[model samples]
Target: MTAVVALLRAVNVGSRTVRSAELKAVATSLGHTEVVTYVNSGNLVLVPADGASPDDVAAGLSAAFESQYGFAVPVVARTAAEWELVVRALPFRAEAESDRSHLVVYCWDGVPDVASIRTFDASVYGNETVIWHGRETYAYYPDGIGRSKLTLPVLSKAAGRVGTARNWRTVLALQKLAQERS
Candidate 1:
């Protein structure tokens, strides 16, 4: 069994609300083993059924979740090893020194073109920095993400890929949990 980390977007935010326990049950019902949900914001660590790709796991979970809950939810799934690489390669580590909570990693379905991400004039927020590579975007919101102009909406538009953002602590926790499961 291969451990996979699933990151769900738009859960427990705005009009979408999904209980973590229910998410775990859904995973178990879909044949995932050792299902565990971290926090309530849609982070799950589970072993994919044999021969299931990350995309298959994510698509299956997303479909089942929407069918059961009546809303379309986007999920970004990564293997435990991939997740660890993302964590290790995160840029702007210095930004976390002052405000670790403001440092976030956005993971999309696949790697967005670096040219597209660079085309965005991120300079509008002089203090903010964005590093795009592979399927992850490492960002630092110096004034706090909530108060910053480089919001998720802006980032999604700029990167040309919609993704879910998790803070440094959440990313670390997921990595730790996935490692333990692996």
Candidate 2:
């Protein structure tokens, strides 16, 4: 069984909400064992059912969320080894967590267009930049995300893909969870 983490995008943020406990239950039903949730942004750590692909696990959770909430919520799954690589590749691991604006984890559904990531216009963001590491893209904006010109909407428009962004602290916390289970 491979350890996988399912990261839900835009769930439980404002008006549209799904309970974290329910997310855990849904994953459990899908044959994921030892399911654990961290925070409310839909971060879950579990061991995928034997022979279940990442996409299979994601689809099960996404379908469950849609049926329960009456809306579709996209889910991104990362293996424990994959997440550990992301943590190790962090450009500024020692930087204060609060200093960075947001950390975007791009779902690895399809091939990411390199041109799209580089063509992004963020001069207004100054120090803020985007780095594509495998399927996930990490962005650091010195200014607040709300104020920064590089918003999630902008990325969606340019990249033509769905993604989720959490604060740096949240990313690290997920990393810690991976370590604990490992």
Candidate 3:
């Protein structure tokens, strides 16, 4: 079996109404064992049956969700090692006194865009900043993410892709969980 982390987008937001337990149940039925969900934001770790590609795992989970909930759902899957790389690639460290609000969004299957991400720098928002391109992003908002332009909804419009966002804490949790499973 291969360990994987599935980052689901837009669950438990508004009326979509997917509980973490339901996500775990659906994941188990889709052939993932040792299923565990972190919080209600769709951070999950599991081991897929042998010979299953990440794409296979994703497609099976998507179909299962549609069949069980009667609505189409999209999922992104990453290997435990891949996730570890993403976490390690953080552009900024926590040593900065101003980086307390820093956040990173997890993503999959996209190229990191150099042009767009470089267009905005730390000076744009005084203390807040947003750097996004393909499957990973680093954001710093002194005020908060809610009032920041670096939000996923805004970045998605420019990046032209649908993806999931997780703060640094969530990323660490997933990395830790994946490490434990491995």
Q: Estimate each model's TM-score.
A: 0.94, 0.87, 0.84
* Candidate with best TM-score: 1
Clash pairs (backbone) in predicted model 1: none
What order do candidates take by lDDT, descending?
1, 2, 3
Which candidate has the highest lDDT of all?
A: 1
Predicted candidate 3 versus true structure: per-residue lDDT over 26-144, tens digit per residue:
88877688888999877778888665776777778778877887776777788888888877777767623354445666474465555655564556545666555447766666676
Off by over 4 Å in 2: 94-108, 124-127
| Residues forming the 10-long window of minimal summed lDDT in candidate 2 | 100-109
How do the residues 34-87 of candidate 2 rate in per-residue lDDT, one tens digit apiece?
Answer: 889998778898888885777788888899888878887888887788877877
- Candidate 1 vs. true structure, TM-score: 0.94
Compared with the true structure, all predictions reach lDDT values of 0.87, 0.74, 0.72
Which segments of candidate 1 are over 4 A away from where they belong?
A: none
Q: Which is better, 1 or 2, measured by lDDT?
A: 1
Model 3: lowest-lDDT 10 consecutive positions: 94-103
Which stretches of candidate 3 lie above 4 Å from their native place?
95-101, 112-127, 132-134
Give candidate 1's whole-model lDDT.
Answer: 0.87
Count clashing pairs, candidate 2.
0
